[model samples]
Structures are given as structure tokens and as C-alpha cells.
Target: MTGRKALSRALDLSLWKGALTTAGSREAADAVTERAVPNEPTVRLTAVRRLYEVSTRMGAGRSLAETLQAVVDGVVTGLGFGIAVLNLRHPDGKFEVIAVAGSPEAREALLGTVSAADIFDGEFKIADEWGRLRFVPHERLPEGEVVGWVPDVPVSADPSAWHPLDALFAPLHSPDGELVGMLSVDLPEDQRRPGPIHRELLEIFATQAGLAIDKARLTDQLLAEKVRLEASETTFRLVFEGAGNGMATLAFDGPEAGRVLRVNDAFCRITGYPHDRLIGSRLLDYLTDGDAGRTRRELQELATGTGPYRFERTFRRADGQDIWLGGTAVIVAQGKDQPRILLIQIDDVTARKDAERELQHHAAHDPLTGLANRRLLQHRFEAALQRSRQRGRRGVLLFSDLNHFKQVNDRYGHEAGDNALREIADRLLTAVRHGDTVARLGGDEFVILAEEIDGTDLDALIRRVEESIGRPLAGIDVPVTASIGTAVVSPYSADLDELLRTADQAMYEAKHRDR
Candidate 1:
């Protein structure tokens, strides 16, 4: 072999022996160590072997800190370096000593370099052949940068003098093969600089170290996620058990439609069903037939994406009492195997519904006669006009006034007068069709809004009204007559006010003609 080739061969063999010592025995380590140069081969071999061993223990190391410490231990011990530091780039854009291995003095010196100011914004070069180690002083590094421990002066040398130490660095990469930080080893002033073998050994060690560290980081993230999932389960359980409002989950498309999957305690309390009784039961079983049927249709429509999730339904409680329930449903899944689960929330609204019904009754009906009042008459009048314009349906308005009814109140008491008015309201109701509206517009003035009528039906309607109102006043033993005037509501855009005015005018003319 040529001289250069022989030397390179020797170097390769030496490294192999160092790597092979663990791969083999002590004789293998000495086989390469005795060649031409003196080196800590056993040390580099141990570090490389340490890297291999540590790399194997990846699944056990659950934190990056533990993994980095293992790497630095291999670095300082395997290379006989004065100091070893594992500096990692943090999220805050700073490099800090996350792990260190060295003598007490060396470790303290390396730790002194750790501060908020130690940002990893520096530059250096790695030779392509000896591609791992880069030695640089603090001054050559970026601002606020610190690397390597202070060099130890020899005891035989000058005591007052201090010597500078240089850092030997290797890149630590992430799982994605991106350089995330550096693994730095250094020597005291009396120790020699790192040579080719030192650089090569460190480079190899770093490759494995980076893999171990990144794997450990990923393991830590997984562990953290597991902890979060357990905590979330606990919190959700607490909320579901202690909530005040009724809540339940329903399964769609089961043999028992809307079968209750799960129900909170509040839901059981609201529905007056025990936990065991509710679980296997259908939700519609507890609701009125009409409302339950409507809800089932709406839920089917909901699956077709054609309805709102929120609706009002009346439920039949366990005691057969009815209660209004405001409810909302949300589908949580899709597909047949995983039938859509509905999360339902319910609130009792029976009292509110009752109050609303009472208010509507008072607004639409007269207190004395229980007939529709003038306000309701106006509403129906406007609605009839709209229906006539839209559907080509005809209507009739019979304006009837009680003639000389004031004399009954003048002679008899007002109580008897009220009785007379009530009797007239009864007669009016009996005369009109079931769909018609007979409204008292104060005093003895009453109007009938008969819908779905035509010119042919008007005469029959007028006859019914005139015959009913002309009956005797039973309490007073006297006859009461009424002037019943009619106006036809054509299936055209007829104004309500104009029609009422014409009917009123015709009523007065009828009164004069009757007198």
C-alpha cells in the first residue's frame, strides 16, 4: 500500500476495533490501538458503544432531558473530554444547557454559559471529510453565545495565568433529520485539541444520540396526551352527573325508535322515570301522541337536513300530567353501523305555555258574551281579504244591530240587559257556520264574518240570522227585532274598511225600512 492509503487503512481499522471491542473483546480493541498512534480508542469505542446502547433504550426514556443526559454521559466518558454539554434550542429562540457531563469544576464552568442571553444564532463550518467537530472560542461565536468550559491550568504551569479552552461540537438532529441543537465536548488547556479520530467518533455518536433524543421527545408528547385524555374524561363525568338541566342521548333507527342510550340524573327527575326504566325506553313513549308523532317526523326530516334542531314538544309525565318541553337535538355520528346518536337537552315550559294561552284568550274574546270582540273581527277581516285575493274564495259580512234594546235596560236592570246581550250572542253563534266568526262590536252592534261562502249561500245565511234574532226576549216577555244587513265579499281585492262602511250604511237603511 502507498503511505497515505496505508495510514487511512490503519485509521479505519483502529476505529473498527474500538467499535468492535463491544462487538467482540479486549484483544480486538488492542488490535487497532497498537498500530501507529496513541489514542483513547477504548474511550471512543466505549462512547460509540454507549451511543449504540443508549439508542436501544429509546422506548424507556420518556423525556428529552433524560435522553440528553444519557448522550452527554457517553460523550464525556467515551472521549475523556474535560466537559460535555448538550445545548438544545428552546421555543423562545435561545440555546440552554439541557444536559451536562464532566468533573465538578468543568461542569460548573459549562453551566456558567447557560443564561437567557445564550441564543444559538452563530455561524461555523464543518469540513466535508471531518464533518462533525467545530472548535470555536466565545469571541468568534454570536453575541451572548457561550460554549465549552474554562480551561484548567496545569499545576506545574503558572498559577496566575489562565488559558482558553476550545469547544468541539457535533450536530444533534431531530427525528425529521433537521439539526435542532449541538452536542459539545471540550478539553482543558493542558489537553491537546480534538484530532480526526475524535471528530469521527463524535459524529457517529451524534447520529445515534439525535435519534434517541427525538424519540424520547415524541414519547413524552404521547404520555402527556394520555394524561390529558384521562383528565378530560374525569371532568366530563363530573359535569354530566351534576348538571341541573335535563340531558339525554338517543339512538336513531333502532327497532325501538329514539331508544334512550344514556340519560343524566336531571332527565330522570324531569320525566319522573327511574334510571333503569328510561334506558331501554323510547323517548316518544313519554310524549303526547300528536306531539310525539310530529317530533318523529321532524327528526326524520332532520336526518334529511330539512329542519331545525330546536323545537317545542308536550310530554306526558309519569303521572299522566302534561308538561311543555323545549327541546334541541344534535346528531353526533353517521352511518348504519354507528347509528346517529342524538344529544338532546330539555326544559320544562308548561307554566309559560299556560300563561300565553290565557293571554291569547283574553285578547280575542269578549268577557261578558264569550264571543269574538271587534279586535278579533278586524284580524279575521284582514285575513279573509287576503284569502279572497289569493285563493279566489268568497266571504260575507252580516252587520246586525239590535233595534230599541236600550228600552229594556231603561226599564229593567242592567243585569237583565247583560242577559239579553248574552242571549243575542248565542243566537248569532247558532246562525253562522262553524268556521264563521260572530263578534260583538260593543253595545248591541254585532258582525258575522262567514267565509267560504258565495252569492248562492248569502240568502240562506241572511235568513238564518233574521229568523234567529227575531225570536222573543224570554225573560222580559217581549219580542226583539234586529236589522240584519249583508254585503258580499267578492273574490277580488276588496278593502275591509270600505266593505264594513257599506254594510253599516245598509244596516241603517234596513232599520228605517223595518220601522
Candidate 2:
């Protein structure tokens, strides 16, 4: 079957109207539909319709190679050419015979054959320009240089008759005016050279072929991009859902800011909440009340693209238990049409947090007395001094020592001495006011820091400590008494060492007086 007839059967002509609509050219459609004027030449009217048919067939969404073949076939069978060849340009500036028609032998021999760009340039140099078409007459042809696919046809006796060696080319260009290919035709069916009218029809068909090729290439590119996007999305889904750590995507802007848009199974497991219930819910809703306000501020800073991505936060689970999460978040800014998002990933760190708190408590407290040790005492002393200065309040530091503590150990034994020390520690705790710090500075020495104390309050505080310590021991038969000394602290209280020194000296004086 002829190539045009085969193509017509393969493509749907119902697409003709649709093709015209897609091209955005209502004029072409109008020309096809409009009735011919009175006494219009039957030849011109028939030829115009042929051009329209060829254009719509090319636009019927065929593959690029198929479309190129159809273009050459339409030129031969539809436009009255005995032979046609489409030479397509390559990146290296060479032209390859991609499609041919009119003669079966020519199609077999010329298809896939390449021609150097300079060879076509040499032919055009000697050819006459017929508007957009180039006409190379037999007499003008260069010697010893073959141009394109030349058919074995005999020369005519008449000077104006179409000759076998005579060449005609219509340059096919992209919409951008780049020469993408060349269409060469020879042996017009009338056995004469193509007139201006025939050249104009060929020019119009070439323009249509160029546009169709350009559109087909664009469609191929779009299809390729779609395939890549689908692949990337599949990879992302696998990583996001199968991750070991809890993961969630939150909206970072608009009315949905801070709200969870999606959560992986791990995140649901960590929060003890189901997937359906968590969507559109604020992540801060799961935070403990104590941490809510502070966490909200930090999240706001993070959303604004500031602050560290790493954080440790406590969240209340569905079962009313608190869990700690240590994780990092990635903030995705809003692009042209993209929504701002926060991709948060976390691991359950409740056990780690509990261990850390236990270690911190042990480091700050005395193991023997269960009271503040020297390290903790210094920290409290510094804070109290700051408050005293800021509030213009007065405080006092009371230093005390057990009288003859070594003698208690010697008479009652070291175990009994330990029991006696426990009793003294308990008494010291009760004797001090609320918020005061009582610390054991090793064996037999205890210090109390009392803030906002007046002269009368200081005197009363000292008497209470002596009375508390002077009581009988719980297990030891020996009596226990403590010599107490005090140092007044004003807003001017500067040195912790000087305060402790003054209190220590007074305690020794009291011990001497009591003896």
C-alpha cells in the first residue's frame, strides 16, 4: 500500500478538528470549512484543500519518524512530485536522508544516507532563490559533485522541462527559524519545472512539517520528565515510610502552620496516636503543659528559619505518659507553587533522659547525708547573693560544728558516730526556713544559707540551730551539741569565701566559750 494510504488508515481523521484546535489556528480551519468563491479556479481550490489535508494528517499525533515519512509521501502523491527526500540536520551539522517517497527504489537507496553540510552549501551557492524555495536548474549544476538522492530520469528536450539533474529544495525550519531539515523534490508530474504557484504550495507544506516535528519533540521531552518524577516519588515513599525513626511532615506556613500534614507509622507508634486522629492536629498539643509555652516559642523561631535544627523535647503520649524525643527537623521553604514544610524525624529518648536526670541528681547531692554537697552549696550561695543584691534584701550564712565530734567517735565507735551525724543532719533540715539550703561540708561541719533575714530573724535562726543540734542522739548514749556562728549578708555581700571565714571564726569562739 502507498505510505499515505497506510498512514490514513492507521490515524483517525476524527482528530482533524482537534488538531486544528490545538494548533490555535482558527484561520486554517476556516479556510477548510469556508465555501469556495464564484468561478474560483478548480485547480487552486483543490490544491488548497490538499495542503490542509496534509497538515492535519501530520498533526494527528503520530511518532516523529512516521510523521516525517507522511510529510515526504504527501509531497510526492499529494503535491504531484515524482520523488521527494527529507534530509534531517544532526548536531554535527550533517544532514541524513531520514525519509523518502514517490519511488520505491529511491526510498530504499536514499533512506539513512548522509550528506555533508558543505555539499548542500555548494549546491545552494549556484541555485536561484525562489522566495523560500531554492531552484537549481540542470545547466547551473556543478560538475563532479553529487548533491542529494538524484533519481535516474532522462533529461527533457525542452529548455523549461523538468530535468533529472535539476534540484529543488524547501528548507524546513523550527518555529525559532533554525533550519532543522531540507525537503528536496524532483520530476513534477506535469513534466515541467514547478511555477511560482507550485513553489508556494510546497513552501506552505514544509512550514507545516517543521511545526509538527517541533511539537513531537516537545511531547517526547514532557513524557521523559514525567517518568523521572514518578521514579523519584517512589524512592521518597519507600524511605519515608520504612524509616526506623519516627517521621512527620508538618505545614510550616499559612493557617496550617505547626499542624501535622502526614506522619509515618513510627511517629504514630511513638505518640501512641493513630494516623487518622493525628492529621491536622498541632504537634504542640502533645507537649507537656510545663513545656508547651517554651516549646512553642522555639518552634516559632525554627519556622522562621533560625535556631538549631537539633532539639530535645518532652511530649505527652496518648496514655498520659511523658516521652522524650531527640531529633532534627528540616525546613523546606515555600517555592513558587510549593508549600512550606517541616520534615521532623526523631528517636525515642525517654530512657536516656531518665538516666541523665539520675546522674545529675547524684552529682549534686551528698550520698551520705542526702543533702546538698559542697558543689551544690556554692551554686545556691551565688544565686542567693544575686537575689539579695537585686531585691535589696539581707541574708545570713550560719556555720556550725559538733562539739568534740572526734570524742563521740572514740567513745561510741565510728558506727555510732555515723548514726549521731544522721540525727544532726535531720535536725539541721528542720531548723532552717523553707527555700534555705543546708549543706554538709564533710564530717561534723554543716552550713545553712538563709535569704531575706533581718537582725532579729538572724538571732532567732541561730538559737534554733543550737537547740536542734543540742538534743540527745537517737542511738548513741553520748550527748550531742553544736557551736553555731552567723554572718550577716547585705546587698553589699560580695565574697562567699569571706562570709564563710567570718562564720567559721565565730563558731570557734562559741566552742571555746561553751567549753
lDDT of each: 0.61, 0.69
The numbered model that scores best in lDDT is 2
- Candidate 2: segments with Cα more than 4 A from true spot: 1-242, 304-308, 333-338, 407-416
Cα-based lDDT at residue 395, candidate 1: 83
Q: Which window of 10 residues has the lowest lDDT sum in candidate 1?
A: 1-10
In candidate 1, what are the lDDT values of residues 135-182, reduced to their tens digit? 554334345533332232221132322123234567676534456667
Per-model TM values vs. the true structure: 0.47, 0.49
Q: What does candidate 2 score in Cα RMSD to the true structure?
A: 24.4
Task: State in Å the error of residue 434, model 2.
Answer: 1.6
Candidate 1 global TM-score: 0.47
Error of 2 at 131 (Å): 58
Deviation of model 2 at 476, angstroms: 2.9
For residue 225, model 2's alpha carbon misses the true position, in angstroms, by 31
